[model samples]
Target: MVAPPIVTLLASLVHPAAGVLVGLGIGVAGGVALLVQTGTQPPLAPARSAASPARERLPLGLVGIVAVFATIGGVFGSFNVAAIATAEASGAGAASGLLLSAYSIGSVLTGVVVGAARLPGGPRSRFLVAGAVFGVVVPVLVLAGSLPVLIALAFVAGLATSPLLITGSSLVESIAPRRRLTEALAWPPTGVALGATAGSTLSGLAVEALGPQSGFLVTAGSAALGAVLTLATVLFLRGRAASADAGSTR
Candidate 1:
């Protein structure tokens, strides 16, 4: 959503392909700046032992589940494209930006709400619920008849994103081996990068082959898949907790 506007603006002045190049340039610059900033930061304290987690390290099953949800998060980028196309097709090109803005607004609100009030659930459970909610909301985008309505749906769909993201990372942090905390955190974004590439390509295809409205189903499906994985994670964790409890009693 953020890069597209820059691409469009630059493309109008240059070539479409060149716009992508420029966007990439900007991204590289920003990334380098971020790296420099982070590299300069000092460690808070001397290293210490990790809290005794449910495991020594994250289970492969848990890693896979987190990756699945991260992919669902990445699919939101595809939704922005599909939404923009739909808006332009409807002859309200001027309002197309609102779709992105509305979605972002929802994410911002999530940070605020999550910070201000505690939601009742672990990060994993909340992540599952958020994924499911977005799954249901994304499909409903097809039913939107006006630009405003589409924006509203986009906003609602975005409500789940940051919460899922924050919780997913927290879950990873909680389970990550002490020696590999940074490595564990890296997987979520890696999953996001792979998913975004695949999602944008597939979303473009779906829009071309299935029509813009139907293209949205891809994103919905991705979220639903994540929700399913999250549900399995929840069940697995519950079983572990129960087993641990029974053993303690014995």
Candidate 2:
């Protein structure tokens, strides 16, 4: 939430490169702080015996979750480029900072609420709803004519983001085997990185070829794909559970 405003301030006061350097510095400091908190870390898991089952491959459901996260990341990447282009076209380049801040604030607020509340549904069901909401909200960004409108839509889009991400990670924890947990968890973030790169590159090209609004189309499409993948994953899991129950009866 704070990064955008701070980066914007530093960029305006110094140079854009300086702002980026400061952001990197802050990230490094955070890492250092975490590393120094060794006493707060959880105890290491017990070593597995040689006779234990070989490390299982990741489930298809977990791969679907990673894909959903990738689509979400694409939405974020496309929104960043589109927001900047739209703000610049409106002769208010600084407004992009506000737009991004609004997005971050919305996510933070929703995350807090979601953390405290006992939402009524399984992770998969909630994830499906969140994905659908995200997909539905992103396309409306293209209709934003004013700064406030754009910011509002950005915030709304952000509202669904936290739930989607939280549920995705939770689903990873639930679906992955203990032996493969670390590896499985890593894939979602990797997916996000890959998707962000693709989204930024594609959206940049789209904005250059068409207009600022065209970038939102990329986000909308990605979000829609995420929703579809989430549905398929839910169905796949249900089928797997049903098959397991039948086998157990036999």
lDDT scores for all predictions? Answer: 0.70, 0.83
Tens digits of lDDT, candidate 1, 2-63: 45455555665577688789878888999989887966565674545586343446555466
Alpha-carbon error at 49 in model 1, in Å? 19
In the predicted model 2, the residue pairs found to clash are none
Best by TM-score: 2
Regions more than 4 Å wrong, model 1: 1-26, 34-57, 241-250
Model 2 misplaced stretches (Cα beyond 4 Å): 1-5, 39-51
| Lowest lDDT block of 10, candidate 2 | 1-10
For 1-250, candidate 2 gives per-residue lDDT tens digits of 4565567767877897888999899899998998899885667867889997676788878878888889887887887888888888889988888888888888888988987788888877887787778777767787888888999988987787888888788888888987678788999998888888888888999999999778888888888888888888888887887898999999
